[model samples]
Each structure stands twice: as structure tokens, then as C-alpha cells.
Target chain A: MMLNLAPNIADPDDFYAELVNSQRNLDEEQALRMNARLILLLANHIGDRTVLTEAIARARAAG
Target chain B: MTNHIYPKFGYLRSKEQADGVVKRHPIVVIGAGPIGLTAALDFAARGQPVVVLDDNDTVSIGSRAVCYAKRPLEIWDRLDCASPMVDRGVSWKVGKVFFHDQLSYQFDLLPESDHQWPAMINLQQYHLEEILVAKCRANPLIDLRWKHRLISLKQPADHATLAVETPDGIFTMEAEWVIACDGANSDTRKMVGAEFTGQFFQDRFLIADVAMKADFPTERWFWFDPPFHPGQSVLLHRQADNIWRIDFQLGWEADPDAERQPERVIPRIRAMLGEDAQFSLEWVSIYQFACRRIDNFRQGRVLFAGDAAHQVSPFGARGANTGVQDIDNLAWKLAMVLRGEAPEALLDSYHEERAYAADDNILNSTRATDFITPKTKVSRYFRDAVLELAQHHGFARPLVNSGRLSVPTPYATSALNTPDEDFAIGEMRPGTNAADAPISVAGKPSWFLHCLGDGFTVVTFGKATDKTGIAIGPLAAKIIRVGRDIEDPSGLLAARYGASPGTTYLFRPDQYVAARWSGFDETKIIEAMLRATGQDSARHPAGQKELAA
Candidate 1:
């Protein structure tokens, strides 16, 4: 069972890969991880603790 | 009458035939290179009449530059040209570094940027120019003059008079402001009498574009101490025209006429290639680089931009990319000046902001250049040692990445910023590791969205409000209150910007946080903005001071 972010795209990794792994040099897996780090940092800057938790949880679940 | 038959690209307006003999535009740009074209695109998109002039009749040949940074691509996206550039260009995500043909390590630009739209694209300079020229040509308001050269210019009290040499004769056209985007060896800078000084390389290197048949990795292959060729190492890059850009870093003692014989050059390349590697030469160039910068960006109405302002070695391809960013910064400010939304004094920030960027690029490129061709044996050994450690330690890899490449820059020390609680905020230059710093937004084009209360970001933590009436400097700017709550913030933005009970941030149009205030003495915040924008100070007038026409 998967809690889809959107319809039809069951594997979140596909969209995540497009968003996070579309770039090369920093491999797709690495890009997803880096994007996660960036998201956390930005969420911290925004002072959004809840979003940060959700983001991290989502990232971990996807991985 | 001297007759020069020319093919017209629509925006090429001959001074001989115009509604008016000379019309003063809001912004007058010199040179139609990448920087100038981007400026024109930005300013015109914002409903500004833009004029671009170039001395050359056609686009520049050869792969002069292909590397564009994330920020520059976002600027292109704003111009609606990023899609074409992205589509036409190849995404070189990871680069393979080989020491003596043995793979040492691979580094990727993707993870660094988090797979943003502004991914590193290997499109040629011709592609960039083609898109820019086409965009400019379509704009009726943008008068792009090809083959028209700016011989000399005069900046008087109100306007600038450019003595442009056209096919028929010298034509005089007055402009409100002039932005010079001439290449590194800029002639427009000379007329303004601005001095550019920095590092000049002694060794002249050869870059030959060969259409190689071999199917090497699409990524950049940097061979350090190629066993076959001890003295000269090969740097290969795939260009758009199915040609490979090969740079043979010959030692400083080589003669200038090395490329005169392709037979001699072909064999040096043949050693590295497969037996069936067939290729033909597209273009070969000999260049000695200079890591130099101008003293100032603005001289009255005439502003120097791009290579005219500064030139760094092409180690990281920061030369064209940085220069293009200068235009992006200046274009909006210039549009404001013309539209009368902001005062002419607002233009002064162009010098202040980009001069710092120029200084930063020079330092970055110089370090990279030095790393590639280590002048001293000690430095050479140290760089090689780092490469060696890079094999064993993950910590060492980032150290090499930071050596000579475009990193996001933070505006920490900028006069625009004030002392925030986080002193670390003051160090973000455009292309430094500071750029690696996280802004509040995720999966967004902006490095940082700056969740300030929607006024000029005054970074001073306390009391920026009380000094609101104080004159900061030439850029007379006033602050507005969007009334944001830092501590008890509600919304994704409030959480991201840390809009807590007392946290605050000021954001500029480019989305850079101007200043973050933690409830400090408001005067210092006002003082900083005044000084930064050239307002709040009596040196330049605030609002409604038109050019003395």
C-alpha cells in the first residue's frame, strides 16, 4: 500500500528522480539524498519544523 | 555613396532610416554578446525599450563557452529561453577524472544543484547567441544593430552620445544609459577610462575542436599526466556539432606556431584515441588567459559589463557565465530607472554589487587556473596530493570540487546586508560554497526565496524600523511593513523562513535575502539599505530626479 503524492505515478521515485536525479555527475541516488539535505536546510531556514519532518519521513519512505 | 549590401534580421535599425535622427532609450547596451543579449531580453521583457549594438556582422564561431551556471539558466527561464537552451544542450551530469588513463574519481553537478532546471548544459556559444539574437530580433522595441561599432562615447549631464561607425558614416545616437557587454578584451571599457587589473598567464595554451569518432563518455574526461603524453595532458568535452573540444595543456616553453602542423597535432591525439578513431579539425586556437578585474563597473552613464568589466581564466567556464549574471543584475535595475519606479541613483548598485562579484570570480578562477597549471612545485604536489587522497577519503572529494568550479555565492559581506544574528549569513557570494547554503524553498529555482515581510530585506536583527526616515546613502530607499510574525508563523513559508515569534528576513526581487532583522536598532538596517541602493544619502537624489536633458 502506498500513499501517493499524486494519481497514476505509484512509484514516487520516478517523479523524485525527475526532480532530484534529473541532473548527472551527482548520481540519481546521490541527487535524491542531496535534495533531501537541501530541503531540510531550507525548511530550517523557513523555521518550518513540521514540513521538515514530513519531508524527511517521505524521503526515508521512498528510499 | 558607399554601398554595403546586408541581410537584415529585422531589429537591425540603420541610423540612416529612423523616425527620429537620435532617440534616447531608457537603457542603451554596447555589444550583443551573451551578457548584453541577456540584459536586453530581461529589460525588454519588463517593457523597456532596449538597444543592442555589436561590432561584428555575424555570431562568433567555435566553442568559446558551453558551461552555464544554475542562476544564469533561471534568468534564461524568466526570458522563456531556458527550454530551448535545455533541449538543445546535453546535460553533462558527472565528470570522470583520470590520472594516467586510470579512473580516479567521478564528480557530478546534479546532486549539488538537486536536479534543478538550470542543470549544467553543454550547448555551444552559437546556440546561446542564436537564441538571444532571435529573441532580440523578434522584439520590435529592441534595436539590435549588427556590424555597428561604438568608436567612442561621451557621457554628459543627462545622456550619453555614442559615435557609432556604421556602413555609411559615423552616426550619433544619444542614450539614457550605456551597458558595455563587449568580450573580455572590451573596447567600450577603454573609452570610459576604467582600469581592469589582475593575473595574466605567461603560457599560451592551444584548444583544438576535433570531430572524434570515438564513443567516449559524454562527461568531461580530464586526464592528469597521461602516460602516452607526459608533458601535455588531454582535456576533452563533447560540443553540440558532434565535435570534441580537446585542450592540450602544453608547457610554458612551447613555441606559438605549434598548431601550424595538424600532422604533428594529430599524432599527439592519436596516442590517446582508439585505432579506428577518425576525426577532422574544426577549429584550433592559442590563448594565454588573464585573471583580471576593472577598478569600477560604473563611470557616470556608461557602465562596463561582461568581459569588459572582468575576465577570469576559462578553467571553470566562469568567464561568460559570471559576465552574463552581471547583465541580469543590471537589467532590472535599469528598467526600474527608465520606468521611474526607482531613481537613477539605483543604478549605482550595479557597480557595487557586480564589482564584488567580479572580484569574487577573479579569485575563484585564479585559484582554479593555478590548480590546473601549478606555478610552483609545492602547489603542484599539494594539488596532486589532494587528488591522491580523493581516492581514499570522501572528505577529500569536495575539497577538489571546491578548488576551481562555480559554486553558489552568498551575499554575506555585501553592503546590502546588515549584521544579522547569524553572522554566517554575510558570506554568500554568487558562485562560492556559500551558494551551497540552503534557502527556505525546496525544489524551487531560487537558491533562497527569502521569507521576509515583503519589503527590502534589512538583515539587522533589531530596530530597522525606527531608522526608516534616516537617509542611508545615494540609493534613497524606504521600507514597507507587510507585518509578518516571525515566532507564531502560519503557512509553509512561515515555517521555511522561520517566521517565528521574532525571526525576520528581507527579500530582494532576485530573491536574495537583503537583510535579516532579529529586532535590532532599525536605523542600522535603514542605513545599510540607503548605502547599498545609493539612497538615504544626499549624494544622489531620491525619486523624480530625471537626467539633465
Candidate 2:
């Protein structure tokens, strides 16, 4: 499957707020771990090889 | 002073003091440390008169700045002082990094062969200084004055007048140009009122120089949270005279004075080297480094180089290596400006180019320091994760920064560079340091770097019949025809420059590539030389018209 480039989240602001809220009151180290787990969980959910590679490339290039 | 003997040159009164005359010199270099002495040698080699003043009579007291990189060695080779240093130094090219008890990464610094020097050589600061001081004393043009300090500096646009304190008394002297290599705590920097700003590392490193006779190979060994020192990093390197330099990372809260005691230090070494290892402490010191630099390298007639101009953490051996390159970049520019061959505006490029290098060094140093000693909890976790991943994954190996091990960064964005018009493979581009390849000169084996003259060079790959007269404005560019003046029999030189024949590379006086062309074009070469010398304003159409004839 092709990686989705356009906005797909129905409620983008609410989703961002939920993502931020998930790590609320957590220490910096714990928040970092939570982010890592979140990334791996989302990566496994989208199990398309080409899409995963493109997503990783896009994230690194944006950096 | 404990294990090694310091040689005292002693104080000597100058003839100017005896005559009681305030004489003016061509160039005055402050601080006879490695940087100042090397600058004096370079100036003298260029037939320039120089006077070096230092407060102390002896070389550096301890084994500081251990790792000397390849570029600095090549610079010293041109100055005729690399032989003894290489002879006495412990040359190494392999480095091993460990996480706890397991090996994380291993690297070969110089994989290719035929180069004159190794990737790096570990030598004490004092020993290198002595070798440089002896070379300086032998040169008549270098007037090295020991036990003489600069009391005050007065810059008057045209020249700088310095009040020097000596054994006799305070005497005044003048120099057309003054270079301050007085090191990190520079009095000359304070005198000039230049703003030095950067990040100060909150951590400390306890440098322990211990003399030991061991069977271990000469290599750099670094550890991240090793079993011997849990939660702290350690660096190990072997120097000359059987002295092994070990740096132990101490957090900011560790008491600097209490940690330096032999009672506290001996146990740590014993834990690292095992219970039965025999060694004697040669020197010990707790140092907190700051990565900072002066806003500009040049102020009026006075200039700053080495640690006086910029400071960096001990990681990557950027301290003295970067300092040597600073002098390498500045000395040639100063010589050109003084000789009237180049305009005074050429000196501004010194600050531009070297400050770029200084910023690069500070960034690398800060990154390494942060990785080695993470200030925040998340940073420490990230560093630990990288170290853990480094053992299994190739991608994480590059992320593990145990001091990026000092390689000269190319000034790719330098204004002096004529952006490559012809495609060439490999890393040899405009504004990059010239790489050395083994070649034969005069029917004898000689390196590629040794054959380059003391001025701008056009390294052209051609046969004996292909001789061209190329001039860079008033200056004639020295041409080294690869197949004639030098022979690349193994084809390494040609391969490195990406040339079969008819490729020309214009090199600056400091041996950095200014431009390269597919064929011998005098106009393009002259234009590049004009730009390199900061005469780009004359690089317009009319000036090109005048230059065409």
C-alpha cells in the first residue's frame, strides 16, 4: 500500500492533544519511552513494507 | 615533574634591552607553547622574522593534549620537525569501543596505505613542545625568548606596541603584527577585549597519566559504563616513554580535590587494570572544559590563534589539532598581506574560514561531551539506548559518538572556493585539504605533499610534453606535472584526484584546494586565484578582459 501523505486523522487537533495527554505527569525518561513504544505500535499497525520504508525516510529527511 | 624531567631553557636578556631601545619586529608571537612555536617555525620557513615570548622557561608541565592528528603531522613535516615526533610518538590507527563488558564498535582510522604518517600519534604536550622549541632555536629567524611575558598590549592601527616583562625589567617593543597563542587563559585576549562566548560543560574529566610497561597494543580504547567504572565513561591511549593516558569521567557533583587524591585514584585504576597491574602515577589533574571561542580571530594588528582564539573539550583531540590548523590557515594569510601580494582584506578570510572551523569543532565537541555525559535523564536514556543498539545494529554504530576522532572538515562553503566546474570522484573537492599519495620525486620515493612548493600550486596530471605557463595574477603558480616532475606509478595519486590526464587542481598556500578544472585554462585559473586572495571585486568582465592578454 502507498503511504498516505495527506492528512488522514479525522480530528487532527484532538488527536495531537490526546497524544500529548497520554504522557502527562510522566517524567522525561518515561515520556521518551512512551514515545518510542507509540512509534513501534503504530509502525506494526501499518505493516506495509513499502509504506514503512517511505515513512522512515520521510521522518529522517524532515529532521 | 614526577616521572618525567622538564628541561629549562632559562631566561635570556635580549640585545634590545641591553641597548635600551624599543625596536620593532616583523611579527611577534606570544606564548611559546606548541601553537606559538609552530607558528614561529612556519613564519621563519617563509623567510619572515619572528619573536616568540613565553612566561615559563619549561615545556608544558604534564602530559596534556595527547592525540596529534594526521593533518598537523603533515604541517610539521613541511616544517621539518615531524621525523623526531613520529619516532618518539606511539602511532595507532585502531580504536575499540566497549559497552559495559561487551564490545560495541571497532574502527580502523586509516584503512588505506602509502601515506607518510599514521592516522594519529599519541605524544605528551611537553615532549612535542620541546621538539618544536629546539627547531625554533635552530632557526635564526625565530627569536625565542623564555621567561618573558606580555604585560600589556597597545594597538595603534598601524602596529601593536607590547610591554613585556622579563628578568631585566619591563621593556617595550613593537610589531607590525602580533599573534597571541597564549592558550586558554589568554592575557592577550583580555588585553584586546574580544568577546569569547560558548557553552560550558558541567562535567569534569580526571586525566591520569600513568607510566606502565604493558603488552597491550597501541590503540585507542573507549568504554561506556564499563564494569570497572559503572555509569561513567573511560578513554585510554598509550603515549611515548611508556606513559599511558587514561581519562575518567567524573560527574559535576564529584569533588574535584578529593577525587584527585592518590588514595582515591589508585583504587579506580586498580579496578580497571586488575589488582596486580603495576603502574606509577606521572600526573593527575581534574579539568572542566568549556567549548568557547573569541568573536573574531583578528583584531587590528593583533591576532589570536590556537586555544587563545577557541577552546574545545578534550574529546576528538580537536584541541591542538584544530589549533594547528588555525595557524596553518592564518600564517599564510598573514604572510601574503604583509608581502603586499594580497590585500589587507585577505586577512578577514582568516576569521571567516577559521571561525567556521572553530564552530564546527565546538559543535562536534559539545555533541560528544553530551553523549559521553548526558545532562538530562532523557538524554542519558537515549545515549544508553544508542550504546545498546550499537552492539547489534550497523545503523546505531555511527550514532555512538566516543569523540568523532578529529578529522579535518572541508570548508565547502568558503568564499575562496571556485565551486567545482568539473566532476571529480571521492572527497577531494574545492576548499578541502590536499590528500597525500605516495609518488617518486628525483628518482627517489617521496610523498605527494612533500613536492608542493611554499606558494599556490597547480597540480596538473599530464605527460612530459604537456608544459604550460600558468600565472595567478602577479604570482606564478607552481606546476607539478604528475607524469614528469612526479610519477604516480601505482596510479594512486591519479585515482585520488580522479584524473587520468589533463586535470588541474589549484591549491592555496596552505595546500587547500582552491579550484579544479578538466583542462589547463589560464583564465579560469587566474579568476580562481583572484577570488582565493580576496580580490573577487576585480573578477568582473573588464578585469577578465585585462587578464586575458
Which model scores highest in DockQ? 2
Model 1's CAPRI class? incorrect
Q: Give the per-residue lDDT digits (tens) of candidate 1, residues B285-392.
A: 777789888888888888888888888877777877787778766776776667664568778777777887777778887776676777775555555655665676
State in Å the error of residue B305, model 1. Answer: 1.1
Deviation (Å) of B492 in candidate 2: 1.0
For model 1 chain B, give the 10-residue run with minimal summed lDDT.
B429-438
- Name the best candidate (by lDDT): 2
**Mind giving the per-residue lDDT tens digits that candidate 2 earns over B160-251?**
99999998999999999999999999999999999999889888889999988887789899999999999999999999999999999988
Over A1-63, each residue of candidate 1 has an lDDT whose tens digit, in order, gives 233356666687777787644566786555555554444345435555565566569878896
TM-score of chain B of 1: 0.80
Per-chain TM-score, chain A, candidate 1: 0.39
Report how closely model 2 matches the true complex, as a DockQ value.
0.13
